[model samples]
Target: MAKRQPKLVLAPAQGIPFNLLVLSQSNVRRVKNGVTIDDLAVDIERRGLLQGLSVRPLLDAGGQDTGTFHVPAGGRRFRALEILVKRNRLAPDAVIPCVVKPADGDVSAEEDSYAENAFREPLHPLDEFRGMQQLVDQGGKIEDVAARFHVTPAVVRQRLKLACVSPVLHEIYAADGMTLEQLMAFTVSDDHARQEQVWELIQSHHNQSAHFIRARLNESTVPARDPRALFVGIDTYVAGGGCVVRDLFEEDRGGWLQDAALLDRLVLEKLGAEADRIRAEGWKWVEAAIDLPYGYHHGLRPIEATHTPPTEAKLAEVATLQAEAEALENEWSGADEIPDEIDARVNALDERIAELAGGSWNYDPAEMAMAGVFVTIERNGELSVDPGWVRAEDEPVVESEPHGEGEGAQREDGVDGDHRQPGLAPESGEDEVQTEEEDEGIKPLPDRLISELTAERTLALQDAIAGNPQVAFAAVLHNLVLATFYYGRAESCLMVTLTKVGFGFQPSGMKDSPAAVAIEARHAMWKERLPESDRDLWDALQMLDANEQAELFAHCAAYSVNALYEVAPKYDNGRISAHTVERRLVHSHVLARAVGLDMVASGWKPTADNFFGKVTKARIIAAVTEGKGGETAALIDHLKKPDMAREAERLMDGAGWLPEPLRTPELPAQADLLEAPATSELPAFLAEPDVSGDEEPMAIAAE
Candidate 1:
C-alpha cells in the first residue's frame, strides 16, 4: 500500500508575498494524468491566483515537527513554484498566503477550476469566426489573421469562405450545431454554378431518413446527373410527378388522344375545305357587311359559286354589280336622313349670303354691270356708248404753254416715246412743277405716310449698306452697338441718316472727307458698345494688330457723337469758322483719352493703331461707297482677311445686308478721294453765329 502524505497548516497574512513556498516539500507530488504544471503557471501569470493553495497540518508518530501540507489540489501551482525556484526566478524560502477551504464538504477543485475557466475565459466559435473574418475584410493575409487569433489558417479560410455562401446556409451555421469541418466538407464540392443539379438532389433527398441520405451521398460522390435519379424507388415520385400528371392528364385525355390520332385527317380534309371556303366567300361577306349599316336587317343570302375561268362577260357582270352598289350608296348619302343641325347650318349660310347681296347693291350692281359689259363685249366686241357719257372722256384736260423745240411736244421718235400729255409743255426758261390739281386734284398723302417714310428710310439704309462697301462696315458696327445697348430705334434712325448723308455726299465728291471721318468715328464708338459676348465684336477686336487697336481706341475716345452734342453749344452762336471747329478737335482728343482709359479698365487691350485703323478703314469705306456705286465687293474682299472675315460675314449676314452677285457695280478706286472736297466744307456748318446782331440774312432769288 502507498503511504499517505502528511499535511501542514499556514497562517493567513495581510500582505501576500509575490513568491511563497517556491520550493517543493518532500511530501509534495507533481500533478499527473494529462495536466501540465505550466498551464497553472500561465494562468497565474495572466491573473494572479486570488485564492492560494489549501493544506492541512501533518503530525509525526512522536509529535515532532514534520513540515508537510496535504494539498488536495493546487498541486500544479506547487509544482510551478518548484520549477520557478529551480530557475531562480522565485525565492526558495518565501511563504505565499492562501484561503484554507475544506476539500471534502465544499465544491471539488475540479468543478471550481471548470467554473472559473468557463466564466472567466469562455471560447465562442462565432466570436472567433467574426474576429478572423474582420481581419480578412480589412485586407489582412489569412495566415496573419489565423496567427493573430491563435487559429489554424485553414480554419480562418473556411470561415471566410462562408461569405460566398447563401444567407440561408449562414443562418444554419450560426445555429451552433454545425461544425466548421462539416460545413467546409459540405461547401467544398458544392459549386453554385451547378445549383440546379444540387437543388434537385436536395429536394429529392428532403424528408428522407439520415440513413437514406448517407446512402445516397455514398452512392454518388458527385450529385446526380438527373435529380430524378435520387428519387427513384422513393414514394415521393408518386406524390410529385405522378400525382401532378394524374391530376392534369386524367380528365382531358379524350381530346388529347383524339387530336393526336386524327391530326392528319383534320388538316387534310376538314381544314383544307374550310380554308378554301373562307378564301372564296370571306371577301364577299366582308364587302356585304361594310355596305350594310349597323343593326340594319339584311336577309340571309347564300354565297354564289366562285368562277374559275375569267371572261369579259363575267367582268362586265361584276362591274354592273359594282355600279348598282355605288348607286345604292349614292342614294343613301343624306337623302333619307337630313340632320336638323346640318339643315339649320345650310339655311343660315343661305340667309347670310342673301342678306349680304340684298343689303349692298353697290358691289352687286358693279359686278353685274361689269358682267353685262363683258357679255356685250363678247357679243359685239365693242361698246357703242356716247363719248360725253364716259366720265373719263368728260373730264377736262388742262393744256400747258409749249416750250422750246426739244422740250415741247416734238416728234415721238425718242427711245421711250413721247409720254408727255398732248399740248402740255413747259415754256422757254420756265421750270415745270406739275400742279397736283391739274392731274387729279393732287392726291393727298396717305395717313400712313410717316410710317411708310420711316420704312422706306430703313429699307433704303439697308439697301445702301448692302450695296456699298463703305456703308456696310459702319452699318454693321452701329447695329452691333444698338443691339448691345437695347437702343434699336436710335441706332436704326442714325443708320438711315448716315446712309442718306453718305448718298448725298457721294455725288458731291466728299466721300473720304472729314464728315466721312466723323461718321466712321461714330461707328467705331458704336462698335465699342458691343456686348463682350458678341462674336462679331470679338472677331473685329481680334482683327486689330496691337498698335491698330490702340489707335482705334484713342480715336473713338477722342471723338464721339455724344461729345459733339456737349460741344455743340459752343458752336450754336452760328458762323463759327473752320478754325473754331478745328479747335474743338482738342476737346475731342481729351474725350478720346478718357475713352481709352475706360477701355483699358474694361479689359480691352489698349492699342493706338488698332483703334485708329478701324476708324480709318470704316471712314474710307463709307466715303468710297457713299451708299452707292456697289462697292461692297471691294470692301468685303478687303475685310475678308482671316482676322476680320468671319466677323464681317456674321454681321453682314445677320443685318440682311449681304448683296447678291452682279446686282451692283464695283466702286472706283478714287471714290473715297472724290468725297474730300465736299467733306472739307463741314466746318462751315459747325461755325458759331455772329451773336452781336450784325449778321446779315442770306437772300434767295426765286425762279
Candidate 2:
C-alpha cells in the first residue's frame, strides 16, 4: 500500500522585462521589517538582484496568454527595478531576473507570496555582531561600516565590542546564562583572561550585576579622580607607557588607571621631588607621605614661626590684580552672564592675587635645626608642606623647680608630662600652678560643677583620641561582641553597642557633614565588598587576610561607638540603669584617652547648626567666651537666641571648641586600659540581631 510518489513542482527562474512586471495585491507581506524598498533598490542597482522574484504569467478567463506578468513575491525587488527604469538608470524594457510560477495551479500567487514572506529566518543577533566584527577585522573603518549599514559609528563600535567578548562568555550568553548588560560591563576591561576569571568568581555567588562586575574587574585600578591620578596627569601617565581602561557603556569618571603600581611610583617620585625642593629651606628633616592621617601631628609641638610676607614688588602686583578683579566684578555685576574673556580675566587676576599673597612660614635658624617639615598631598591634588613641627623627642630638656614632698610634686593622676595639684588651676594668661585649696583630698561637688569639670577633661581626651582610630575601633568592637553574643546573660561589662547607623534622620545640613560623609563612604565601600547573600558573607569575609580583616573589623566596629549624652527617660528600666550609663561614660572616656581622640584634629569645628543650635544660649555664650574671649562673647550676648547663636558660631569658627558630649571626659592615667581584645571569632548568638532587650535602643549618631 505504498503511496505513489508526489510530484514536486519547482519555481522557474527567467529574465523578465521591468516594464511588464506589476505589483500584486495578493502578496502576503503587509508590515515592513528589514531592508526598506529604497535601500533594496540601491542595493539592487549597485549589484544586480542576487535573488529572483516570483511572478505569475497573466492569463484570461479562457486561460489565453495575455503577454503580461504580475509579481506575487519579491514585490520590493520589482519596485526597485521600476525605480531604476524611471530614473533612466535602466531601459523601460530592461530585463530583471525573477522566478516565474504558473498562474493557474494549486500553488496560487497568494500562497507563493505568503511562503516567501513567512518561511525565511532573519539573521541572528550574534551572527550580525560577528559579521560587523568581520568587516572591522578586514580593515573596514567603523565609519564606513556605519554608513554602509545606515547605522551610527557608536552602534558599530558597540556591536564590535559585543562580538569581541571572550568566546566562552559569548557561548554562555548565547545559552542565556548571562544578561546583555553584564556582557557590556565586561567590555570595560579587555583582558580576556581577567574577564573569564571574573565570570568564574561571580558564578558561585550568582551575582552578575553590571556595577559589581566592573568593580571586580577594576579592583586593582585607581580612579582617574583619585588624588594621585589627578596629580599625575592622565596624558602624562599614558605617555609614560601606563594603561588606562575606559568604560564605553557608562560614565566612569574619566576611566580607571590600570597601572596602580606605576601611579604609586609616580606619586612617590613627585612627592620626593617636592620634598627635595622644600629641603632647600633648611628644614632639618622633610617627611613625605601620600596622606597624613587624622591627628598625624599629635604628640609633637609646633614652634611659633612668622610667615614671610610678600615682597614690595609682589604686594604691588597683588594690589593691581585685586583692582582689576574688582573692576571686572563691577562691570559684570548687572549682566546676566559675563563674557568668556572677561570671566577668564577675572579668574586670572584672582589667581595672581592668591599667588602673591600666599607665602611659606619662616622659622628661626635655631628653630629650623630642631624642627621638621611634613610634605603630603592636599585633597585637590596639590602639594602641601607644613613646617615647624617639633617632635617631643627633639625638644630641649627644661629644668624642673626644686620641691619638697608636697611643694612641687608631680601629679601621678594627671596625664604624662602634666604636673598640677588635684584641685589646682592656673589663672588665665599665667603659667600652670598648684592652688592651696588642693592641700586636702577633694570634697564632693555639685552635679553641675562636676559636669562642667568633666566637660573640659572630655575635650582634652577627645583631642588625644583623634590619633588612634585603630585602638578606638578595637575597643568598640570588643564591647559590641559581648553585648551581642551573651545577650541579657552576657557577662561582659562593656556597654558599647551599635544601633542603626544611617543618617536618614539628620537635619538637612548635617547630611553632608564631614563625619557623616566619611562614615557613609566607608559603609558604601564595605557594602560593595560584602557578598549580596548573607550566606555567602561568611565565606567572603573568610577570604580576607589578617590585615584586610582588621581593616574591615575596624570599619564595622567604628559604627558601634556612642559617646553622645541625653537625659534618660523617667521610667526606671532594669536594663538601662543609671549605673550602666555611668559605666559607659567612664569606658568611653577611657577609650578616648587611649586612642588620643581629638575633636579639633578630627576636623570638627563648632557651628550654629551642630553646636549652638542644639544647646542652651548660656552654653553658646560660654563657648564663645572660652574660644574668643569675653569681648567677643559680650557682642553676641544681648542678641536674641537665634541671632546670638549665629554670632557665636561665627566667632567660634576654627576656635577648637566642642560641646560637653563631644569633649573627651577626664580620666586618670591609670584608667587608660580601654582597648578591647582583638579576636576574629564570631559567636553563634552574635550572628543574629539582638532581640532580648540586650542592647538599649539609644539615639546614637555614628557621625
Candidate 3:
C-alpha cells in the first residue's frame, strides 16, 4: 500500500505538414464503415477538421525518426484531408494537428488503432434527438442543425420533436423500460400527465404494444374519420373552440378530435338547424338527435310521397348511363373478378343511372300535416332527412253522427255489420226489439290501421313462404289465379311487393354473417341474369326453368322477412289498436321450426364477447348447466364472474346451446322423438348480484 505509483505519461501534441502525413497499414480498422471519405471531406471543407489525427513517426532500419508521420488511428480523417488537398481546397503544406506518439514506445501502431476503434461508443438515438433539440433551443436554425448532422430537414424535425415528450418517458426510453417506437407513440399526445397515466395502466399488461398505448391515450377522443366528427367539419369544430390532436410520428388519418362532448353538441346543433328547416315545411313534428335509437320508426306508418316525374334531359342522361353500364357488363361477362377500375366504373354508372331515373320526393302539405320527420346524421356523415313518417297518434280519425248502429263493424261471430245478408236478419217470428247480441258489433278498424295490420301479416307470410319452397310456389300460383280468375274480388294473406325494406340499424357484425353473405351472393347472381329493362323482366321469368323460377321467388320473398323485435305499443286513446309485433314473432318461430334452423350450426356460439361479458354470473352458470350439466358447471361456480364466464364458454363449446333470443322454439314432433335426461344434483350455483349495488362485487376470489 505504501509503494509509490508512477505518473501517467501522455502523447505529445504537435502539428505535422499534410504532405508528410500518411495512412498507416498497421491500423486495426481492416473493414471500411461509417461515413464516406467524400462526405467527411465536405464536412472538413465546411468546418476545418474537428478531431486531430493520431500519428507516429516512421523509423528507418536504425530505429530513428524519419521526419515523415503515419496516421495509426484516425486514418479515415487523414484520407478525408487528402481528398481536400487533391481537390485544391487545402494547401499541400497545410499543418494538421496531431497527437504524436514516441517512436521508441512499446505501443505498436496496430495497438493504437485498436484502442481508437474499440474504446469509443456510438451515440444513442435518443441522445442525438435531445442534442439536436438543445441546439435548436439555443437559437440554431433547423436547417443549420440538419446541415451539421448531414440529415434531411424533415428527419431532423421528426427527431427534434421527440423532445416534446415527457421527461419521465425519455428516462424510461433511456433505461430500456420502453422501446423507441412506443416512446414515439407517446409523442402523439403532448399531455405528459396523460402519457404517464397510460404508462401506469399498461406497464403490467402483457399487451404493451405501441398501438395499445396510442389507443389508451385516445380513449375519450373521437378519430377524424368518426362519423360524428366528419359530420361536423374539423375546421368548423376548431372555429367553435374545439382542439384537434395531431400525430407527428405517423400518418394519423387527419388526427383525432379532442373535446368529444363539444363535437357532439355541434353535431346536435347542426341537426337541429336542419330540423328547423324541415319544420318550416309544416311537418307535424321534427325531431333532431345526433343518433336515433334502433326501431325509432316503430309504431309509425311509412308513406310514399308523389315524386316529380323525370324530365326529358334526365331521361336521356339515364339512357346514356344505361348504355355505358350495359357495355361494361357485356365486356366483363364471365370474369371471376372484374378489374377494380372497370368494376368501379360500372358501379358508378349504375348509381348515376338509378339517380337519374328516380325523382327526389318530399312530403306534400297534407302529408306533412299528419306526419313527422327525423333529422339525423347517416353513417356516411351526410344529413339524412327521413320524412313522411306518420305516428300512430297523428293518424287521422273518422267521425260519425249519433246513429242506430255503426255502418262498418265486426260482430262476435266474425260477421261484418255492413257485410251481413238481409236474409240473416231477424224474421217475423222473432221479437223486433234489439237484444244485446244483436248490437254487439264493434266499429271496424280504420283504413290506416287495417293497412298496418296487413303489412305485418304480409311480412309474416313472406317469411313463412320463403322457408317453405313448396308454399312459396303455391302462394305465387294462388295470387296469379286469384288475379286472373276472380279479378279484384279475391283476397289472400300473401302479398308480394316490389318494395324491399332496408335494415339501417343492423348490428355491425351482421354485415359479415353467413346468412347475409349467402343472401348477397344470390341477389347478385339474380341481378346479373336479369335484363336491364323492366319490360323484359316478365319474359326473362317465363324463360327460366321451374326450379329457377321457384328459387327466384323465394329470394324475392326472403327480402321481406322482418324478424327484428321492434318497440311498438298500443295507446289507450284508440290511436293504435295493437302493434301486431308479437304475432310477427310467433310466425317467425313457426318458420324457423319448419326450416329446422340451427343457429349453432349456422356458426353462432356463446362467446365471452357476444354473450358472457354482458350477462351476470348466475346467467353464465345456468347456461353451463344447460349445455354441460350441473356437475361440470359447478367447477367454475366458485370463481369470479369473469373467470366463470370464460370457463363456461370453454365447457359449453359444441353443446348446441343458444341464448334465449337466438333459440328457435322446439317443434312438437321433434320434441316427442327426444328422450328426457336424468337430473342429478351438483354443487349449488352462485346467487345473483345484490340489487343494493353497495356490496363488494367480483370478490368471489381474492385478487
Candidate 4:
C-alpha cells in the first residue's frame, strides 16, 4: 500500500464491428458442450448478447493497433453474433459488444478464455427451478419461458411440478434429506398436507425409495391403470369432476385418480346402465356388481343362446380382415422380429376378427323368464355381461310332489329340486364352459399372498390352545354343552371343534415355526409315555392324571383350529356353505382374544421369506413404515424389492409386526404414529423470493 499500488490500467470496453471480430485459437472450449451455437444465437437474438467478448487488438511487430480484433473468451458469443451477420439478420459491420485488450503480453488470450470456461459453475437444479418458478409467477407463459431458456416446454413443466410438493419436503430436498428421485415421486400429489404426511411417514421408515414414495402417495387414490379407472375413461373421469394427479418426472402409467370413490361410483353407474340395457332384452332379473364372486354360477342352471348369423357384408369384412392377417403373417414369418407397429396391427386385426366372428347372442324368452344377467368388469377393463343364470329358487318347480302317495319325492327319479335350465341338455354340467381358474375364482387364496398369514395363523392358533388350558376347558365345555343342549345345531364354532383340518395344506416354514416345534415336542412326549397300539390308547390315557388329560385334550382340540381363510362358497358348492366362515373368523378371534393370544408373545415374527418376500415391495415398505417409523421405512425404500424385503425383515424383527390375517380387530396403541412432524409452512428460498406475496420467510432459516 505504501508503494502506491501500480497505477492499474484495465482492458478498454468498446464495440467492434461483427466483421472485425474474429474467433481466436486461444479459446479453450474445444470440446462440444452445453448450449449449441444455434441456441446461443437464438438467445442472443432474443435477449441481445448479455455478455461482452474478451478480445485483443491485432497489431504489427511494432505493437501498433490494427483495425481487426481477436476474440479469446466468449467464443460462443462471437460465433452467435457472427451467425446473425451471416443470416443477414444483422449487418456485417454491426457493432458487437467487447472488451479491448492491449497487444502486450501482460495477459494471454488463453488465460482469459480458460478463466471464463474454468470458473463457470453449472446452475443448481433447485436454483433453476426457482428461476423458472419466478418466471411463471411473473405471468410468463411456460412456452415463452422455455423458448427463452432453450429448453422444451415439457422440461419447464417438470421443473414447475416441484412447486407442488410440500414446502417441508422442498426444504428437505434442498438439504439433501431426500433424494431428487424421491422428491420427483412427491410431485404426483399436489396436496401439501398429504405430501408432508407421506414425508413424515417415510422419514422414519427404512424404505423411502422413489417407488415406495409414489405408492405411499397413491395409497388412497386409484391408479390410472386400475380396472375401475380404466373402465371409466380418463377423459370421462375428468369430465365428471374427478382430479387426476399426474407425475411429470416418472412413468406414472397415466396418473392416479384422487377420487377413488368417485371412480368406483362411475364404474358402478356405467355397469348398472349396461345391466339395465341387458335386462330390457328380457331376463328375470339383472344385477350389476364390481366383482362377481368366483364360480358365481355354482348350483345355478344356464341356458344356451344363439348368436345372429353373419350377413354377406359381414362375411366380406371378415374375408378382408383374414386376408390382411394372412398377408402380415407371411410377410413377417421369416423375420427375426416384427416391428411393434406391425405386431399391434396384427393383434388389433385378430381381436376385430374374433369380435366379428362371435357376433351378438339372442337368448330365448322362455329361458330368460327364469334366468338372470350379471354385468361386471373384466380384468382388462372390458365389459363382461354374464347372462342365462337361474337361481335355485328361480328354477321351474316340477310338480313332482308325488302325484299320488305311491309316487316318491323328486329324488326317486334322480331328479330333485335341481331343475335343468331351458334350451340345455343334462350333460352340460354347471360351470362346464368355464376354465379351471375361472371356476375356482380365488381358489386356495393366492399362494404367496396368504402363505405367511396361513402359516403364522396355524401356529398362533395351535400354540395358543396348547398354552391356555383355561380357554381350552371353556372351549371344550362350550362344544360339549352345545352338543348336549343344542342337539343338531352342534356346530358352535369354527375354532375348537373336533374336526381336524390337515396341516399338509399349510404353507412351508409352518413346521419350523416355534408353535410347530412346541407342538411336535409335546406330541412326542405324549407318544413316549402312551402305548403305541390303538387298543391300549384308552387305558394309557386313563392312567394319566386330570391335568394330563386336560393337556392332551387341549392338544387334540387345537388341531381343529382352522383359522385359514378360504373364499367361502357363494352357494352350496359341496361344503355346507359355512357362510359361518365369517362368523367363525369372528368367533375364533373372540376365543383367541379370550386365551390372550398375543401373536408376538406366541413367538410369531415376520421374516423375509415368510412375510416380506411373499408380499409386494410396497407392502414390505408399508409394514416397515408401520413397525418402525417412516424415517426407518425410508431407509430401505430405494432398495430393489428382494433387497428391500430382506432389509425390511431385519428392521421389522422384534418389532411385533403382524399381517392383517394374523391381527385381531383391536389396533395397537401406535395407530396414530404416522403423523407428520411439525414443520414450517414454506422454505426460505421460495418464501424469501416474495416478501409481500405471502407470509414471513425467516421463520424456518432462523431455526
Better of 2 and 4 by TM-score: 4
Model 3 clash count equals 0
Candidate 2: C-alpha lDDT:
0.72
lDDT of each: 0.40, 0.72, 0.75, 0.74
Q: Order candidates by TM-score, high to low.
A: 3, 4, 2, 1
TM-score for candidate 3, residues paired by index: 0.61
Candidate 2 residue-wise lDDT, 466-489, digit = tens: 678754644444444333222222
What stretches of model 3 exceed 4 Å from their correct place? Answer: 45-48, 60-64, 86-92, 139-144, 152-154, 157-162, 238-255, 278-284, 305-365, 397-703
Output the lDDT of residue 393, model 1: 27
Tens digit per residue, CA lDDT, model 4, 1-703? 4776788777688878888878898888898888899989888887787888888888767878778888888988888887888898899998888888876767788998899888889877777788899999999999999888878999999999986578788788889887888888888888899888778766656567898788767767888887788788999999999999888987779888999778988998999889889888889899888876443454455677877977778778988999999999999999998999999999999998887877777888998999998788876789988788878788677684352221122445554223333344545553353244355454333223355588889788878987997656655644532322222133444353355454434555454467767877886676567553334444555566778767776765675677665554434556633344555666677788778788898888888767888898888888898899998988888877866776787788888888877877653256444553453232121122435866543311110
Model 3 lDDT on a 0 to 1 scale: 0.75
**Model 2 quality (TM-score):** 0.54
What digit string (tens of lDDT, one per residue) describes model 3 on residues 30-137? 777988889899999998989999988898889887889888899989889989989999999999999999766898888989999899999998898889899999
Q: Please name the candidate that would achieve the greatest lDDT relative to the true structure.
A: 3
Flag clash pairs in model 3: none
TM for every model, in the order presented, reads 0.20, 0.54, 0.61, 0.55
Error of 2 at 170 (Å): 2.1
